[model samples]
Target chain A: MTEFLQQLLNGLSLGAIYALIALGYTMVYGVLRFINFAHSDVFMVGAFIGYYLGHHVPESTVWGGLLVLTAAMIGCALLGMLIERLVYRPLRSAPTLNVLITAIGVSLLLEYTGQLVFGAAPRTFPPIFPSANFHLGPLTISSNQLLVISVTLILLFALRFIVMRTKIGTAMRAVSLNPRAASLVGINNDFVISFTFALGSAMAAAGGILYALNYPSIDPLMGVMPGLKAFVAAILGGIGNIPGAALGGLLLGTVETFVGGSEWSTYKDAIAFAILIVILLFRPAGLLGKFTVEKV
Target chain B: MDWPLTQMLTVKNLEVCYGAISALGDVSFSIAAGRIVTLIGANGAGKTTALRTISGLLRAKSGHINFNGEDLTRLPPHQIVARGICHVPEGRMIFSNLSVDENLAMGAYLQRDKARIAQNRDYVFSIFPRLKERLTQAAGTLSGGEQQMLAIGRALMGDPKLLMLDEPSLGIAPKLISTIFEKIVEINRNHGLTILLVEQNARLALEISHEAYVLETGRVVLHGPSPELRTNPELKAAYLGG
Candidate 1:
């Protein structure tokens, strides 16, 4: 029972990270109607940025981590917006293939740029807080894991509220529904697209910060695996649904934890791809996702 | 009416192209305040294209679009929507994933008046009571007629002064068509809303419109009062079921 409970915490914490990263993929896909292949790179940059902030700033000051996290999130958000405006926006009229290829190009740029600046090797990510462990009943959990799960839950709820209740959220949905109709109603599609990228990147930045604490490692290439895994989570939850991404992430994490808890740790990565294939075959829209038929 | 007749919306020599294929060519038209102006055409004619251009979905290859005295040729879609020109696009582009109610709420995306939005939703429900019954249902599950109602209802959420509807009567039962068209008239009369309608349903559009523009192969070949155009020999032969 205790072992199962421990795995549950670990799964949820890991799931939280995947959910945030998955959101970036889902949000961009929702608005642009294309696979943002570069989204993984954004997640990678998040970890690197968090690593720098966590390490460069002294560990004693609480404000420093907060400031650094905030700054990194803002920086990554700006990076996302810049990539969209400069790279994706120009190809608005271009074919889907072109956009997909451009995304790959952007991914390469982010990856190589990180390698050049941060060096080729992975760096050990410093802990954000003291190594404190808590045992409740049979389940033993770390403060870091609790912190990750709580923060992830809070951010997810906040995002859901913004998307469902706010004016900006309506605009995003409206633009995605019918760009022309939205515009005729006097909506600026460009603005919505820009917001999509910014919001996605910011989420990725938060994910990066949280992920570093949980994983205790960072590098330019770090985002690649997590990004791909999050993509799986996003697809599993439903590609365009916001809540679906989080749900998918949690499910993915739980599956991995259970698998890794046993002797299947070596096949942890394979588990993600296998689950994704099964989900796609059966429920292509993901567990919480819905099917949207386009207006002809 | 004033010389410009307090023009609520105006488009001059609006040209739109799909890459090498030109969809609308030098398409100049305008709408007065509180009038139903219909643009009637064939399947490939420029009616939808013109609406898309005005809405900023398709950039005009050339020409000017001014709404309420502001040049809108350069602005994007949402900004245009923000300026109160709501478009209920062809094929009813309601968000299929969203709930019927949520889809309606999204129409009022630009407005900050929460009270008014609720009021408008209530009024729209009154106008299309079927929607009220299916508020929680996903929009994709709706019937054809219901989808049409949801599309127009969603547009109403925006509190638009000028509503641009493309192919409102397409792909629905004839019984529902009259009711939908009648509701459009009631909306215009009660709300004093200006409307720009585009349709391939020549007879129906001609019947409902105060004035009409007939397009053929990307150009307005004929224009007149609806009743007069109803009898226009060429329009009858070309578009109306002669």
Candidate 2:
């Protein structure tokens, strides 16, 4: 039972990272109705930013860690907005396939670009927070795990507040419902789309930084696998639903962690794809997603 | 009433096209301040297209739309809204995911003064008490009539100088149609709002309108006062269904 509890904590901690990354997928999909495949590359850039920032700061305190995280989030937010403007803006009226292909192309561009800039060789992520292990009732929790969970909670709450309580957030939802109607009420949809990208990318940055803190490895291709899993998580939660994405991420993390600790450890990545398939078959709209008839 | 009153809005030789198919061609009309002007036509007669063009949703291929003495031919939809032109679009396009209050809040998207926004909210609630009762409900869950009311209410939240309502009577229950029409009259009378109402329900639209224009296949086939158009034998046979 204690072992099960231990695995649960590990799973939740892992899920927190996935949840942060999945939010970008779900939100961008909500507004644009297309999966931004390059989002994972944004995650990669975030980790790289954190690595460099941590190296320069060299003070592994919690406050220092938060400063690095904030910096990474801001950087990724601008990067995300830039990507939306330079790449997706021109293709706003184009067919969905063109955009999807462009996204994959952007992903490759980021990866190759990162490889050229930072080199293809893997670099160890410097510690951004001092490590500590706390044992409570036979369950041991690492400082990184606690940090990941707490930060995830803070972000999720902030996200909920923004999406539900703020005026711009209301405009965002209105745009997602009907862009023409949104513009009729004086919403600059281009600005809203850019803002959505910035918000989503910021969360992914936090995910990237937290993931590095726990795993301590960084590379150009590092985001590929985690990105795929997070996409799967978004789908599992219902692709366009914010809360659904978070729930799906947690569930996916738990299942993957349990599996990884067992003899079928090699099937960890495969498990995500498997769950995605099963979920698609059973509930194509996802666990929390309602099946909506396409409005003509 | 003067035949040619002071014009609040004017469209001159406006033409809109979807590639090769012209949706609106050489459409010219004008609305006086505080007058309810309506465009009555068949479904593909481009009535909605004219309203869409006026509200800046569709760009005019060649022509001019002047509103409140300013040219609005090339402005974006949001900019047009800023110029006090609010369109309560066809199909009652309310945000389904948002609450009734949130939908109204979105209607007042550009309004910065909180106090005035509250007054607008109060006005909306007074006009549609049912909306106030269901302030927390998602707009999609509203019945067709309620949705129509909410759409108008949302538009009113903008405090528009010129309100363009597209098919407000479409898909509404017969019992609620009269009530909605009454609300339309009350909105015009009390608020003194200039209206450009587009409708497929010619009889109801003509009955409530001060001036009426008949559109057929992207052209204005007839233009006259509502009572004159209402009594026309040819219009009665064709549109009013003799």
Candidate 3:
């Protein structure tokens, strides 16, 4: 029972990271109805931003850690907005297939460009926050795990307040519901779309910094595996549903962690894909997604 | 016939196309301030297209749209809306996922003045008390008539100088249609708001409007005072089901 509790705690902390990244996918999907394939690369960029900024800030302090996270988030937010303006905006009225192909291209571009600039060798991520281990009965919980979970909770609440209570957030929802109608009501759809990109990218950046705090190893391609898992999480939660993404991330992370702790640890990665197939077959619209018939 | 009112909107030689298919061909019309003008036509006759182009949802391929002495031919939809022209589109495109209150708040998206927005909210509630009653309800759950009322009420919250309504009578219960039309008249008369109404119900459109334009296959076939167009034998046969 103690071991089970330990694994569950670890699973939830990892799940918190996935939830942060999944939010970006879900939010972009909500407003633009397309998967931003380059989002994972943006995550990698966030880690590198932190790596560079880590050199300047005092390590092992709360304020220093937050500063790195904020800088990474802001950098990635601007990058996300730039991507939308330069690439996606031109393809706004084009076919979905064209956009999908373009997204894959952008992802590859970011990956190879990252390799060129940052080098393909992996580097150790500097400790940004103070670390400690706590023993509760027979369970051991690391301070980094606690930080990940607490930060995710706070960010989630902030996101909820922005989306549910703020004017721009309401406009975002309106644009998602009906773009033409939103425009008729004096909403600049372009500005709203750009804002969605910035918001999602910022969350992904936060996820990147949090993930590095636990793993300590960073590389240009580090985001690919976690990015894929978070994409699955977003799909599991229903791509355009906000709370659904968080639920899906937690559920996926818990399941994957349990599988890793078992005898079939070698097959842990396969488990996520298998679950995706099962979900696609049984509930293609996702766990919380509403099935909607296209209007003619 | 038009002695007092100033020209509020003018469209000259406006042509709009979808790919190669022309939706509006040489459509020209003018609306006077503080008066209701109706464009009555068949489904394919470009009435909705005219309203859409005027509100800058669709760009005109050639020609000009001048609103209150300023050119609005190339402006985007949001900018046109900011310039005090609000469009209540067909099918009553309310954001169904949002509450009735949120929908009304969205209509005031461009307004910065708190007191003015509050006043507009009150005015909307007074015009459609049913909307006020369902303020927190999801807009999609409202009845067809109630949804139409919300659409009009939402547009009114924008504090528009010219209100363009497309098919306010469509898909609504017969009993509630008259009530909605009465509210439209009441809004125009009480507020002196200029209106450009497009409707498939020619009889009802003619009854409520002061001036009427008859459209057929993307061209204006006739234009006259509402009473004169109401009595025209050709218009009656084509549109009034005579």
Candidate 4:
């Protein structure tokens, strides 16, 4: 029972990170109807931002850790907005296939640029927050794990408040639903699109910081695997559904952790892909996604 | 026949094209303040194109669109809406996922005063009490006629000086059409709001409008008082179903 509980805790922490990253993918898809393949690289940039910010602040302090996280989020938010304004805005009326290819091109550009700038060697991530291990019976819980879960909960609630209660947030939904109707009702669609990119990128930044807290290894290519997995989670939960992404992340994390603890640990990564395949074959609309017929 | 009425909107030799094909060519018309001016035509007759151009959704190739002495030719859709021209687009494009109340709030996106928003909401509720009852319901779940009501109510929330409706009766039940038209007449009569209506239903549109323009292909082939156009032999044969 304790063994099961330990794996559950570990899975949840990892899943929380995936959930944060998945939100960015899902939100961008919701507003623009196109997958931002470069979103994962934004996660990598976020971690690097935190790593640079961490050196300037005092380590092992709550305020210092929060400061690093916030600075990274704001930095990535600006980067995300810049990406949308410079790259995506020009192709606003272009075909979806063109946008998809551009996104892949962006991903390659970010990756190669990151390799040139940050170097290929992996660096140790500094301990931005105080760390401790707690034991309850035979099950162990780390402070880093607690931080990841608590921070994700707080961020999720903040997101809900913004989307449900605020005007700009409502406008985002309006734009997502029908861009033409949105403009007719006086919403500036461009502003809303930029805001969505910024918001999603900020969340991914938070995810990067939290993931680095657990893994302690920082590299330019690090986001590739986790980013792919988070994309799967977003699809599993239902792309464009906020709560769906979180649920998908948590479920994928738990299942992957359980598989890793077993004899099939070598195929842990394969497990995520397999689940994706199965989901695609069966529930293409995803668990929470409602199938809507296109209205003529 | 002549009243000292100021022209609220004027379009001179306006032309709109979609890529290589022209949607509206040399379309010219004017609307006086506190008048219901309608553009009646069949499908693909440039009625919707004209309304869309006036609302700034479509760019004009040539000529000017002046609304209350202000040139609206280069303005964006949101800016045109800010200038108090609200368009309830075709097919009652209400945000189906959002609650009816939220749809109304989006209509008042430019308005800042909280009390004024509340007053506008009250006015909408008074006009369509059905919308008030289903305020919390998702707009998509509403019946077709109810959706039409919500669309009109949503526009009214903007406090627009000129309300342009594209096919208010389209896709609605025959029984509900009369109710919606009665409300349209009531809104124009009570508030003296300038209205630009586009409709495929020629007979009903002519009965309600003060001035009418008949669009064929892309250009305005005829324009006169509603009563005069209703009696024209050519219009009757082509549109009023002989």
Candidate 5:
């Protein structure tokens, strides 16, 4: 039972990060109906930006740590906005394939540019949280892990509140449901679309920063696995379904931890892929998504 | 034909093409406030195309559109909508993925008044009691007649002075078609709205419209108040299905 408890905590921590990054993928897809492949790179950039900012801060003061966190998020928000204006905006009226190809180009640009600035070598992130672990009888969890989990929970709830109760949230939902109708109803499609990218990408960056604290590893390419994994998680939870992404992430993480290194560990990656394919084949609209039919 | 009356919406020398083929050519029309006007034509008459261009969904290669004394020729779709021109595009284009309630809420996208939105929601539900019954149901799951009602209800939620509808009766049953047309007349009478409706059913459109424009190959060939245009010899046989 102690072993099981330990695995559960580890999986939940990992899942929090996955769920955060996956949100960027899911929200963008929900509104824009585009993959926003550059999203993962944004996550990668967030990590480096956070590391760079956090390093320069005089962490002796509470304000400095807060400043570093804010600056990283703000910087990533700007990066997301720029990508939307330059890369995705032009392809707005183009074919879906053209938009997708442009996404790939933007992704490569960010990754390569990051490689130049941060280098290809992986660096250890300094401890953002105190190196202290909490013991619950036989179960143990690090402060970083607790912080990541709590922050993830707060963010997920905040997102839900925004989407359900706020004006911008309603507009985003409206735009996602029908762009043309949304426009006809007098919502600025452009503003909402850009905001969607910024909000989602910023959350992704937060996830990246938090994950770096837990693992202490930071690299230009670090975002790729988490990005891809989060995407898989999003798809598993039913892409475009916000709550589903979170649930899927936690499930995937728990399943991976308990099952990793076992004889079935080889099936971890395969399992995520297989579940997505099977779910899509039967319920292509996703677990929480409703089917849409085009009218003439 | 000069459109000397103060034009609420003016489209002059409008041209719309769909990649090499001219779907609409040199179309021109004007709509005044507090009027019920309609464009009636054959299946390929470019009736819907004209409405689409006016709403800024399709670009006009050569034309000037003035709405509420403002130039809308080059404005984007959302901007035009923001200017209080609500469009209900062809074939009841309801957001199938959204719930009926959510769909209604979206129609007030530009509105700022929280109280007014609540009032407007109540107003729409009152207009179509059937929609009120299916408030939580996904729009796609609604029956054909209910979907059409939801489409119109959604458009009305915007509370625009000028409402444009395209083929609201396309897929509805014959009884529901009459009911919809009756509702249109009631809405106009009660709300005092100006309407620009497009339809292939010449008989029905002309019967309900205050003034009628008979469009052929994108040009308004015959037009006048409904009483005169309804009895016009050429329009009656060619378009009124005499």
Candidate 6:
């Protein structure tokens, strides 16, 4: 039971990071109806930003950690908006296939550019939070695990409030539903799309910070595997459904962690893809996505 | 092009095309302030296209759309809406995922004045009491008639000077059709709003409109005061039942 509980705690912490990255994929898909392949690079950039801040700040307090997280989020949010304006905005009215190709191109551009600038060497992540572990009845939990879970919960609640209770969030939902109709009622859809990118990228940045804390290694290519896994999580939850993305992330994290701990750990990555294929075969719209017939 | 002083909206020699196929050609019309003008035609007669062009959804290939003294043909849809032209589109394009209240809030998105937005909300509620009852409900779950009402109510939240409705009567129950039309009249009368109405139901459209235009294959075939068009033998045979 203790071993089981230990695995559960670890899985939940990993899942929290996956949920944050998944949110970016799901939100971009929600409003734009296309996968932003460059989003994972944004996650990597967030980690780098957090690393730089950690080296400069020289404090291991909760407040210092929060300050680093905020800086990274803001930096990533700006980067996301810049990407949308430069690459995506021009192709907003283009065909879906054209946009999809452009997204893949953007992904490559970011990856290569990151390689040139950040170098190919993986750097150790600076510890921004105090090192502590708490033992509860035969199971031990690290402070980093508690931090990941708590930050994820707080960010999710903040996200909920922004999406459900705010005006811009309401406009975002409207634009997602019917952009032309939204425009007729005075909503600037381009502006809303830009905002969506900013918000989603910020979440990804928080994920990056939490990920660096847990993994202790950061590199230009760090975003690749996590990005793919989070994408799978988004698809598992329902691509455009926010809550579904969160649920899917947690579930995927738990499953992956369990598989990695077993003798067949070499097949951990294979399991996610296998589950994805099975889900697609049975429920193409995803666990929470409602299948809609296009009205002619 | 110089529009008449009384005209709230004027389309002069407007042309719109979808690639090579012409959707509208030299479609010209004018709406007087506070008057309900109806565009009646068969399917593909370009009634919806004309409205879409005026609201800046479709860019005009060549023409001038003069709305409230500004040239609207060149502006984007959101700018057109910001200039007090609100379109209640066909198929009742209410944001189904959003709650009725949120849908209404989106209508007044550009309006920063809290008090006026609140007042406009009250006005919309008064016009469609059913909308107020389901304010918190997702718009998609509402009945078709209720969705139509929410669409109109949502438009009204923008506090438009010229309200353009595209096929508001299509697919509605006969009982609610009259009620909807009556409410359209009431909105025009009470709000003193200039209305540009497009409808497939020619007889009913002519019955309530101050002026009417009949469109055929992207051209204005016939136009006059509603009562005059109502009595025209050719129009009566083609549009109203023989």
Report the candidate with higher lDDT, 1 versus 6: 6
Candidate 2 at residue B84, lDDT?
Answer: 94
Candidate 4 lDDT over B1-242, as tens digits, reads 12223888888889999999999989989999999999998899999999899888899999889888888999999999999999999998999999999999999999988999999999889889999999999999999999999999999989899999999999999999999999999999998998999999999999999999999999999999999999999999999999
The fraction of reference interface contacts (C-alpha pairs within 8 A across chains A and B) present in each candidate is: 0.65, 0.92, 0.88, 0.75, 0.67, 0.96
TM-score of chain B of each: 0.96, 0.97, 0.97, 0.97, 0.96, 0.98
Once fitted onto the true fold, the runs of candidate 2 whose alpha carbons sit more than 4 angstroms away are B1-5
Candidate 3's C-alpha runs over 4 A off are B1-5
* Count of residue pairs whose backbone atoms collide, per candidate: 14, 0, 0, 0, 0, 0
Residue-level lDDT of model 6, residues A84-195, one tens digit each, is: 9999999988998898899888888888888899888999999898879999989999999999999999999998888889998888888888888989999889999999
lDDT of each: 0.84, 0.93, 0.93, 0.92, 0.82, 0.92
Cα error, residue A226 of model 6, in Å, equals 0.3
Taking the tens digit of each residue's C-alpha lDDT, what string does model 5 give over A1-296? Answer: 88888989999999998998888889998888878888888888877877877767764344664566566677788888888988788788899889988888888888888889889899987554445778999989887788788889988999999887777888888788778777777788899989888888888888878878777788877878888888878887888899988977887777777677467887877765676678778977666666655443
Off by over 4 Å in 5: A56-67, A263-296, B1-5, B114-122
- Per-prediction DockQ scores? 0.51, 0.88, 0.91, 0.85, 0.62, 0.92
lDDT preference between candidates 1 and 5, better one: 1
TM-score of candidate 1 versus the correct structure, residues matched by position: 0.89
Residue B169 lDDT in candidate 5: 89
lDDT of 6 by residue, B25-77 (tens): 99999999999999999999999999999998999999899987889989989
Clash pairs for candidate 3: none
Cα miss at B156, model 6 (Å)? 0.6
- Model 1, B22-123: lDDT tens digits are 998888788999999999888899888898888877789898998888888998777778788888888887777678877886777677888998899898
Model 5 chain B weakest lDDT span, ten residues long: B1-10
Cα displacement (angstroms), candidate 3, residue A145, comes to 0.5
Candidate 4 lDDT tens digits, A9-39 = 9999999999999999999999998999999
